[model samples]
Target chain A: MSSIISLKHLYKEYQLGDGSVFTALRDINLDIHEGEFSAIVGPSGSGKSTLMHMIGLLDKPSRGEIIINSRDVSTIDDNQTSTLRNSYVGFVFQQFNLLNKLTVQENILLPATYSRRNLDFDPIARSEMLMEKFGIISKKDSYPNRISGGQQQRVAVARALIMKPQLILADEPTGNLDHKTGNEIIDLFEELNKSEGITLIMVTHERELAERTRRQIRVLDGEVISDKKK
Target chain B: MKLQGVSTLFTSSFADFKRDKVRTALTSLGIMIGVLSVVLLIALGLGLKNYIQNQFESLGANLVMILPGSGFSGGRGPAGLAGGAEFDEKDVRSVEKVPNIKYVVPVYIHSSVITTADKEISGSIMGANEEIFSLINIDVQTGELWKKTDVEKKAKVAVLGNTLAQDLYGNPSDALGKTIRVGGMRIKVIGIANKIGNQERDGAAFIPYTTTFGSMNPKKTFFAIYLGIADKESVTTVKSEVEKTLLKRYDKDRFSVTEQSEILSTVDQIFGILNIFLVAIGSISLMVGGIGIMNIMYATVTERTREVGIRRALGATTRDILLQFLTESTMLSLFGGIVGLIVAWIIVLIVRNWFPVALNLFAVILAIGVSSGIGIFFGVFPAKKAADLSPMEAIRYE
Candidate 1:
């Protein structure tokens, strides 16, 4: 299968207020293929989030080439970068990040509202289907604050999948959920990966959740220590 | 962005505004106060101008005043007054020869004490021809005006104004046929003029012009000449003709003619300037209100930094975010502007019951335009600041 994301020699650096430079990621080289269900496991501040941001086109690498869906990200401007992100990437954050003011349906339809490309299908009909699949249809009119953490995360996941992007990037998706709820979310991600053949890249510190993915790339001190394929 | 997308942004913005009712109401109040003041000021100015014009119209149509010397000259009143050009019987005769001339009533005015059986009061005694009654639309409330024979015969008959008669005899109707002593002469009051609301006409007494000039004081010249034209449209023609006739005998700088339209226009011009000055004062408050909106919107941008990142991450372009915020602040100011208009309208309604203020649609529209302009203008800086935020940094903001 063709690779969906190719990161070649990606490096990210931050400038401290004291004028010292701190490198977040160095000489990172990795490829995430289509239909690959993978988890990036690492300790805190090990550059797992930085790598995820770079892969999602949420931030630029300090020095490197990032090719996503066969297009080099460096050549694209901010507007085109946003278009690329909207067209091919979906993100699930640890905080769920649903706007508190928006109801579940409005939050789920947010991606479609922001997409510049013309959508072929009705976003509302698809949102209804996704809510049914996620078992949260009854809470569709409720705001994010009124729902439980698990329901909010499910709504966030539904939002990420609303545009049917080529790849989904989840950062600590189960960090705030109970163990049983986290396992249930993991099961949903596995089902989506197996049924739709959607590429899934998740960042997590939970070793047990990382073990359930088809592959695990463990990062330690900004370097991938092991890449194990199940 | 598509219309649908813009509408969605507006929907969210409105929901966001509704979430904090107190802040929104207070923010809108700033703009409301500014708009209300501007609208009311303009309305009052226009209303006052209209009221004064109507009063001028009530004096008489087709009436013109010929003043001695230039109007710009100091220490001179209207015609025949001291310290300027002297206009007497010859000037009146010359003005009578002008085409479309109806009645040339030369007034010999004097201030004196009049005594009746019951009281004594100081008042102006005007000596004019019988045409003065019709020229100034003065109706007789009791008895009749003096005849042309009464003026030409130099009769010592008098007409008392409504207020003057009331002051002298305590009743306008009872004052008829009663003799009032002025300048040591006992004159019988032949008529009482209707209430015309002018201090000169409503509170003074009138005597025959020939009697005052020929019998009372043959040396006293006429003070002013009032010309009643045959047709309202012929006023300008008659005025120029009278000026030309006078210029033939005297210098061009010796006299000036003022039509009712000229007076009305000068009054209108003064009120127009006043309207502009008042509106400018009101706009300063509007500008402050705009700045207040800007200050609050800037704070809103800072407060919503995390929200901006979340939207950007959800695929909102920089343009999208910019337009969203611009729409939000513009709507905020527009909301205030509309509320201000409503409040202004209510105030105007209340004021109309007490004063003669005409509501001006143009001024109202201009107020709305200014408010919207302020919103868009002041909102740009803060909206730009919000749009320029880095999405990655924003999303990470706590």
Candidate 2:
């Protein structure tokens, strides 16, 4: 399989209040293949969230070469970084982060609205299809506050997939849901990865959830401790 | 940006306003009051100025009153009477020599009663020289004016105003040759002056100064002088020559010369002061309204933090965020200003109907400019606050 995202010798550091430096990610190199369902698993303070943020293009690494579809994004400015994120990346935050004021359909259409490329797909039809596929079609017009947590997460996932991005970065997408809902969300991600041929990168502390993916990487205290094919 | 897009922003703003109707109404009320105060105050000032100007016009155009005083300073008493010195027939003769002096009339005034065979009306008798008719531009409606020959001979001929003629004789035409007793002396009605409405002259009766001084009060001195300049451009030269002539006649600082230019300038000064006073009051109200706008904008920024975050995350530049808030503020203010202008115009119409004032367009334009400026000035800080929000922090904000 062709690699959709490649990171070489990535390093991310943060300045502590006392002037010391804390390394969040060090000497990390990884390749995310097309149509792969992968997870970065770690304990608390293990830099798993930081790695997810860097991969999502939501944060810049201190030193790294990140090539997504042959574009070197690490050297790009903020505007260009946003453009790259809009064109090639999708993010599903742990807390859902659905805009409370927007309806479920509006939330789902947000990514498409922000993306650099204009998709000619009908928003209403696409929102209805995603909602119907996720078994939340009845909540399409409802506000985020009116929907359940699992439904809101489904809406976020729908929003993430709206732009048909090359890579889907999920930072603990199911962390806030119950076991059944978490399993259902993971199943949905797997289904999307297999059928749509889109890459999936998830972060989680749950071993069972991380074990479900085809590839798993474990981080400990800002360092990748292990990488294995499940 | 596209018109459709701008309209969409407006629609969303209105929707948000609708969601919080009470707050929106309260904010709009603040702006409304501010704009209303500004518009109404300026309108009122303009209306008063127009009324005063019209009153002066009715008095006559380029009409200057030169009273006997010391050196153009003490001519008239505090009540516009001939006080310190007396301007007599000789001064009138001298003033006529000045170029552009269209007519100079010396007046001797007295309060008296006029009586016919059947009726009597009491009013002021204006004893004026023959030139008074031309100086005041009085139109004769009946019979001939008291001629210069009549003034030199002191002919007992009177020109009754329309009202006085109606009072003394039921038919003004019949009174043309009829005799009336004024101040116990009989005088023939030679002419009936045209009616000039319910002004000071409406109740007056004119007679030749020669006849008045020689027949009724021969020992009394002349009271005041009135001069008519040909046009506005000639007023300054005529006034200067009249002043120099008067100063040569009277003691220094004893006589006062007042011109239309001086009176108009005084009126302008009064109006200017009134404008400043009213604008200050309006500005205070506008500031209060601006504060309300600021508070509302701040609340909007807080409430829409997540939306701001979403836009920022979606590649919205800071300037775009700033422009959005500014557009909202400007829209609010512009609508408020328009409403204020309409209300002011309506009120001006009502005032014009009920009073003697007219609305000036300058006031209207000034109100709009100031109100819109207030809106933008007050909107900037809030817009900046909204634009400066960090995407990460705003996204995390509840």
Query: B34-89, model 2: which lDDT tens digit per residue?
Result: 87787788778767776676555555678787765432232333534434566677
Candidate 2: stretches off by over 4 Å: A111-142, A147-150, A175-183, B1-5, B61-90, B96-102, B106-224, B230-241, B251-277, B354-372
TM-score of decoy 2: 0.76
For each candidate, what is chain B's TM-score?
A: 0.76, 0.72
The local distance difference test score of each candidate is 0.86, 0.77
Q: Provide the DockQ value for model 2.
A: 0.22
Q: Model 1's lDDT to the true fold?
A: 0.86
Native contacts retained by candidate 2? 0.12
Docking class of 2: incorrect
Q: Number of the top candidate by DockQ?
A: 1
What's candidate 1's DockQ score?
0.46
* Tens-digit lDDT string for candidate 1 (A1-230): 89988999888999999999898988888999999999999999998998898888889988989987677795578899888888788999999999998899999988888888778888999999999999999998999999999999999999999889999999999998999999988999999999999899999999999989999998877777888999
